[model samples]
Target chain A: MDSRVLRTRRDVLTAAMDELVEGGWDAVTHARVAGRAGYAKATLYAHWPDRLALVRDAFDQVGRMPHHEPTGDLRADLVGELVSFRTAMTEHRLDRALAVLAERAGPVPELVEVRRRFVEDGERPMRLLLAPVLSGARLEAATAMLCGAVVHATLLHGAPPTDEEVEAAVDLVLVGVTGA
Target chain B: MDSRVLRTRRDVLTAAMDELVEGGWDAVTHARVAGRAGYAKATLYAHWPDRLALVRDAFDQVGRMPHHEPTGDLRADLVGELVSFRTAMTEHRLDRALAVLAERAGPVPELVEVRRRFVEDGERPMRLLLAPVLSGARLEAATAMLCGAVVHATLLHGAPPTDEEVEAAVDLVLVGVTGA
Candidate 1:
């Protein structure tokens, strides 16, 4: 709870996150993080017992996503939220992190719960946007489609969706084309 | 090539794949794979010259996906193909592999090409199923949605869809819900 100790903890977590970004999950080790943070290994180990514990603390240090106010116009709101989502992903290289987490989700209950919490938390804002228009499984499915489309387009195809593509996706979810 | 030589190549590739699955992309070093395959390091180097080359060879050794013949029942056929896709993913642990590959795709042209080829080759069969019903960007968007739905449902949710969920996803694509 001491001010200097808090600063040191912040510094260490920042270093761990830097390691994660620079080299990936495999690169986060106590000694490497301690060296980067200008701390003795003993200091890091005294604070966090293991690498996973350190990673969890580092991950928690990431800024919280700000809640978006709905713009009342559905299309504008959807695009705004999606663009914000895309920006966050780009800034953090989150697609890679998500991939790693998703892969580990199977064997690690901690990760599975993490992903579940993420999905639940992420959908909350979208739910507010769609509350008037959509509900239940259909709403959930639509949200997944939109998020998945942006993710695949950005990560796999190497670009964010064109405005046209975004509009098309929105249209499809709102009311699918009839007769094929 | 001599039969003995062919056997050695297969053995080496198999060993490399096991390492890839067990340890990840970082674990595919020539020394480790060669040792696992009972070959000297020189043998691996003589063939691969680098870790990336060995990985490509190992990835290529994964069994080819069997082409699915459409049964002409649109809904049934789509479900059948999706179920098959899900089965293949499970058998090969493909979601995890794809996560790793997609993360590496930007910097690695080989991986990009691999993903491009995979999308092209994988979509060919789906095209046959959809050609009668749809075409153009609509077709492409529909395919991506179906694939994404299956992927998120299976990989993130940790289970393949129930028959009901698959049917619902297909319905949403073919004729999405009206009024949100």
Candidate 2:
């Protein structure tokens, strides 16, 4: 893809995502997205034929917001990443939009693949952060628990969570595994 | 308030819950619930003026599932409760049904109250289990993480978690707090 085309695509997708956040999945219709992006509906349909395609592109954009680079200190890095993700979830409407799309899509293969990729992408940094702090089975369990807790706290509670909570959760898991 | 009337009301609500699980929230219409329960639409209306009321009653029933009594061992009790809840979430459609409803309702005041009640009920037993093992703020954080993890594992992953995973999570939180 040409760089300028890629940039325009990114802009269109970003506008669609904003519409989704503001008005739920129904708001991401090509017409509305194009209107929001100041483009004709034909332009959107030219790039993405269906609602799902548009949503998929919008999700791709939203899913890339997390900075997954790992720092050497597993706890600090994990906490920082979780806090950042949590802040985005709480402050931005995108998280709810993604969740709504996921729920509404049901068992569609494309949506399922998108969900799985989203999960893997979200979990990748945590796994890396944990690999250094833990070894063997302990690392696996800790990573699952940490990621599980963060997702639960943000999605269910409607807040990004505090550093203290994240630190305590990480410490709890690490202590149990190492018996330190 | 009559005994037979109360029984009929309960039956209608149970049928509504079944429909919700079978077809998700959108399927829980008054006529469908009435037909499923072999009741007249008038009876359903008498008991629940709206779909939300019927769904709310069903959610209450689901929440009334058996809870684990504290056994003084925080890790054991926490793990047991989580595993049991995970099983219910998987085996009973009502559990997932209510979750779907809650997510759709978002931050609406009535729905928020329902969510708060759900979390409190789920966390209360775990808190009792952990109280002896932890003190002060650690106890609060531990309960939140444990409860949060279980909810996420079931709702997001759509799988029944094993006792081993629950044990690992409890151990992680317990060890961190007690430094044991």
Candidate 3:
């Protein structure tokens, strides 16, 4: 793509994300995004035909998990995973976007797939770190417990888990699952 | 209230729930519900006055926790709680409804309070059952872990946790928290 076209695409996507973060799914429309990006509606339509397409593109740009190298320390590794999860969910407003997509009627199939992929990819590293300690059904159960604690703490409290809370959750899972 | 009036109210609420389950929040307008309930639109207005009122009444009727008597056997009680959580969330379609409500713009204050009340009330019993073994922040953390597992498992798998998954989670929490 030409440099100018690339710049325009980036600008429009950023505007769409801004709309999403400001007012959620309903607020991101082609016209609104075009207005935010200082482009004609026709220009937006020429690139991404619909609201779903723009939102999905914005998600692709912003949705990412933080990397945390395991230190071969089970408790510390688990805390690292929890912190990374919280960072990814809150920083990119993934939780808010997901809450919207879940409520949407007949959500675009690729968008749903995108979320599932994010979850699976996010868990892959943690699963690897803990594999020696747990496997099969046991590993799955442990993953659910730890991840759920982090996610639900955010949902119920509207904030990421404090360091103490994260450590406590990691401790419960580590001691409970591995007898460590 | 007169028996006939009570029946009419029940019918209207049932119709409202059907609209919600079938078409979501936007579909529960007074006109549509009144039409479905075989009442004049004015009747619905007289009873509900608005969409939020209708939704709140329907939730009050359908949003109830399944009663599970704790057996004083900690693992078993926890599993029972998980099962009850799944049943209530899925059967009443409360989880879907809640995901929508959570994403809704400026949600009705009363409806949000209704959900908060449900979550808190549901936790009270499990708190009592686990109090002997855990309390304070530990108890709260444990509750979040178990509840999050059930809820997130449903969110990811699009199905409730199986019996084995439930047992594994309960076992982990029991052993992890209590050193059993």
Candidate 2, residue A117: lDDT: 66
Candidate 1 per-residue lDDT, tens place, A1-180, comes to 999999999999999877776666667899999999999999999999987788777766653555456778787787677766667667666665555556556444576766655655655676677667655555555666666666666555556566666665666665642322
Residue B35 error, candidate 1, Å: 4.7
**Worst 10-residue lDDT window, candidate 1 chain A:** A171-180
Once superposed on the true structure, which residue ranges of model 3 sit more than 4 Å away at CA?
A67-69, A105-110, A156-160, B105-111
Most DockQ-accurate candidate: 3
lDDT of 2 by residue, A38-92 (tens): 8889988899999889878878777766564666766677777777667666677
Q: Whole-model Cα lDDT per candidate?
A: 0.69, 0.68, 0.74
lDDT of 1 by residue, B74-177 (tens): 87888788777777667767665655566556445577766666656665676678777765665656666666666665555566556565665666666742
Q: In model 2, where do residues sit more than 4 Å from their true spots?
A: A68-71, A105-109, A135-137, B69-72, B107-109
- DockQ-based ranking: 3, 2, 1
Q: Cα lDDT of model 3 overall?
A: 0.74
Q: What's the CA error at residue A55 for candidate 1, in Å?
A: 1.5
- Candidate 2: give the clashing pairs: A172-B172, A172-B176
**In model 3 chain B, which range of ten residues has the least summed lDDT?**
B100-109
Residue B107 shift from truth in candidate 3, angstroms: 5.8
In order, the B-chain TM-scores come to: 0.84, 0.86, 0.86
